[model samples]
Target: MKKIIELKQVYKDYPLAGISQTVLHDINFEVVPGEFVAIVGPSGNGKSTLLNLLTGIDHPSSGQVIVNGAALQNLSNERLSLWRGANLGIVFQFFQLLPSLNLLQNVMLPMDFLGKLSKTQRRQQAMQLLERVGLADACHRLPSQVSGGQQQRAAIARALANDPPLIVADEPTGNLDAATADDVFDLFAHLRDQGKTLVMVTHNETLAAAASRKLEIRCGRIHADTPAVAG
Candidate 1:
């Protein structure tokens, strides 16, 4: 399999009270194309920080973040932004849908920013994605009008709008009830089945077990990385 993402000797630090506090230490990992990997740990173990580094939303303090053979550290901010827009799909714990935009509009926003397709083409593609996520009937509804599950489905649709091969989801099902979380995870499994690479940070062990591989991050390092065992 082709390597889609690689991190070597990575480190991240933040300033606290005029002192540097390291958050991630010497992290090393690689994600192959079409792999579904779950990252789990207690809160503040640098899981979200790691995802931000992979997506190029934030740079590593040291070492490298290579995606698709290009060094993210070397890319200019504008170029990195463009690369992220084209290649990285991100889903957050909270559905980051625009309140002013309906479902269709929210899905179309990425295409608009990327400008890779015409307006009509973007709308058509967004509608298809919404349909795929089982939100076809909710396309015209505002995010507030939908249930939490429906809104999350819409967010997933939006994330897949560009047909990005790599998706980074941080606590995607965190806000939902058990039934809704199950449904959302089913959608994630469907995406994996379609050959998309998924790197998710999750607190739910059930959801983590659904992934092909699991990694435990603790104290800014990977304490374990292994395949999931069937129960």
Candidate 2:
């Protein structure tokens, strides 16, 4: 498989009390196309930071982040933002839906920003994504009107709005109950089957176990990198 995302000798630090504190050090990894990878670690171990770097939301202090063979460090903020919308999808623990927009409108938001599709075409694509996420009937519902699980599913639909090749999820199921989390996990599997590369931050061992590969982060470094076998 071809590499879709790569981090080469990456390091990130933050200034604390006038001293630099390392958050991620000497990180190097590659996410191949159509792979499902779960990054696991305790809280405050730079899991979120890693995701931010991968998505081009934050820059590494040193080294390079290459996505689809292009150096992310060289892109301007506006260009990076546009590139992310076109090539990368992001899902968050809190769902991050717009409270003012209904499910259909929220899913259409990304397409609106892209400005590459007609209004009717965008609506059709959004509805199709909602159907794919099993939220067809909830299209008219507000974020507050849906259950937690349903909201997360809607968020997934929105993330797929532009049909990105890579999806970066940070603790997507953190707020859901076990059963609901399992449903979301199934959706991830479905995406994998559809040839989308997934790099997810998850605390649930069972969920992580379902991935093709697992990575453990500790003390701002990769502690373990291993392939996981299905039971």
Candidate 3:
């Protein structure tokens, strides 16, 4: 089967006071469809940078990032935005929901941006996604009105707005309590079971151990890539 996510000789660098500092060094990996991949590493060890590369938010200094059959590095910004909207969903740690828009509108925003569905259809699909994430009744509440977990659920719903094939999350449950974090993990597992490729950067060891595959990064290199012993 074809790879859903591939990074070839990936290296990421940033300029610090005129010198280049490398964050990811010669990274290479491939993720197939229907895989739940958890990336675990120490703080500031290039985990989030890797996710940014995969999601097209940041470009690799020199490498290829192919996701959902599209070479991300080859796409123009405009095309990349469109492609990302249709092919990938990102769940953020902070639950980056628009404060003014209620949960329903937040979930509908992606569909609106893509414009593949009518307003009515977007609403219907958004409602369904909200329900899928167990937030149907709270759909009308503002992000601030709900608990942190609820907001994260809304973020998940919004991420699924376009029915993207891949989901990339960066510290998605970092802000939630233990019980709530487990709930979010369960929801992600459900998505994985339904054939969505998931790659998550997490600090939670238990969650990492529960994933189908676990990758450990250290000092800008992948130290280990092994099948997770489910806990």
TM-score of each: 0.97, 0.97, 0.98
Clashing pairs in model 1, backbone N/Cα/C closer than 3 A: none
Q: Give lDDT for model 3.
A: 0.93
Once fitted onto the true fold, the runs of candidate 2 whose alpha carbons sit more than 4 angstroms away are none
lDDT, candidates in the order shown = 0.92, 0.93, 0.93
- Note each model's CA RMSD in angstroms: 1.0, 1.0, 0.9
Over 198-228, each residue of candidate 2 has an lDDT whose tens digit, in order, gives 8999998877887889989998899999996
- Kindly list the per-residue Cα lDDT of model 1 for residues 1-231, writing each as its tens digit: 679999999999999999999999999999999889999989999999999998888999999999977799999999998888899899998999999999999999989999989999999999999998899988999999999999999999989889887999999999999999999989998888888999999998887988899989999999999997645
Q: Report residue 171 deviation for candidate 3 (angstroms).
A: 0.8
33: Cα error in model 1, Å = 0.4
Expressed as tens digits, the lDDT of each residue in 45-103 for candidate 3 is 99999999999999999989988889998999999999989998999999999999999
Pairing residues by index, what is the TM-score of model 3?
0.98
